[model samples]
Target: MKIDGSALIAARQKLRANFPGRGEIGSPSIGTQEWLAEQAHVSIRALQYLERGEGSLSNLKKVCTALGISQWQQLIINYGEDYVSCIANRFVDFRPSIYPPENPETFANSSLLMTLDPLTLLVAKGKFETILLQEVNATLTGLAEPITYTWLAEVSLTPNGQGWLGWVKEVEPMNLLANDVPMNVPIMFKQLCVPQVSWGAFVDAVENLTTSQLNIEVCLIFQNFTKKFKVYVSVDLLKILFNEGRNKYLSPLPYRAQLKAIV
Candidate 1:
């Protein structure tokens, strides 16, 4: 979706509102611009242009680096509502520039790659799938470790079709029954298997399987599931996912014990 001009204006207003006494909308640190310019080896005018939102992407990156900020998303959030949607949209489809010297290659495997686009669509549509495919892609790509493994117990839908049936079929050799009811005659069951299935694994599986097919609808499901079972998954995974959305979804303190155990 296109970034609205009015939203940009509102964003600027919000930034200005945050520092009513400053006589200008800019970073809170006094002389921060000059300091950043000096550290980045850029002219003070260029740094001023950035603070005024008139600087180019290169200058902005340099200033952000000099200021010790790793991602621009934080700055965007600080800008407020006008940039919120735009930032959210970007988060969903973020593909880091390979040409940028500081860009990390590992970033390509982040949940951000999948969550951003579908999430933006979800914001626009207000409905999205429960599963996110990009998460699955990352797992499949071996960026993160698996959480669990389980045998596929059943399947009854058309092969390769969308919906639950498609999901079951993809991991076939398993039987998906409507319920635990037994048929008049005993039915034979095949052994279908899924490996590395954790909350992350499940999310990644659903995401990788249905990203193009399901889009934002998948993210809605993912968001709901994550909230419901926050305690079930590793805190690090939760942090990673939240970071992808450019939001803090988990409490860092609560996970200290768990992280210690994992380490």
Candidate 2:
């Protein structure tokens, strides 16, 4: 999966030569190192390494993406066998199937997620049960009209102790699902779960039954939100709200503070 240095250099040179007025490897405009770095989603320094034909498999793929080359392996063919590298195609052999709704299940990877307004849910008219709640309620706690904000929540059902427990992380805008309506404030979520359920009715008894991350192999995917999908979030981080962030968790919320400190 990794690219040979000579191959990358040669490929880049060929691409540059195709452009009008393109001269050097790091010339002005499209040929600039900075521009290429942006396209590859790497830093200026990383681009320097890329030009030398040295980078990890992930970076090589990024470079391929920037250069608009679909056959990433082709980059290696030009480098001669000495620089050519290969890795097992694990994804081709393993992809989890969607779970049946008749029984509960969990997933092995993450999927895309987004926030929704309860009022919007009302208008949409679907089956939305409050599965799990933390310190705050899923609906606004009696906030009058012009209720600009509400808590983002995680809901789920546990059947026989082997149910789907989802893990989520809000993804960046560029990582949003292709061609989906981007969210407003706090947007899309990357969810990880298993194909445990499909179109099955949830027993009222399990509505409040808290599900744990037990007996489940996770599956991940970056998906757009649909009326059919449900949201599952960590209790501590689900306080995502617009402008005034659910207001239930005080300012400098634990999650926000931790994120800021890390960043």
Candidate with top lDDT is: 2
Worst 10 residues of 2 by lDDT: 254-263
Encode model 2's per-residue lDDT on 1-263: one tens digit a residue.
Answer: 23445655666667666665634555545645666677788887876775665666677788778877665653442222222111111110101123323212432121212222111111111212111111111111111111121223332212432233221332222222112222232211122224321111111111222542111111111111112222232222222221132154342211111011000
Tens-place lDDT per residue, model 1, 77-151, is 122222112112221221221211232333332222121111121122112212221121111222233322121
lDDT of 1 at 42: 82
Q: What TM-score do all the candidates reach, one by one? A: 0.21, 0.25
Task: For each candidate in turn, give its C-alpha RMSD to the true structure in angstroms.
Answer: 22.4, 20.7
Q: Rate the local accuracy (lDDT) of all candidates.
A: 0.30, 0.32
Q: Which residue segments of model 1 deviate by more than 4 Å?
A: 1-31, 73-263
Supply the TM-score for candidate 2.
Answer: 0.25
Query: Which one wins on TM-score?
Result: 2
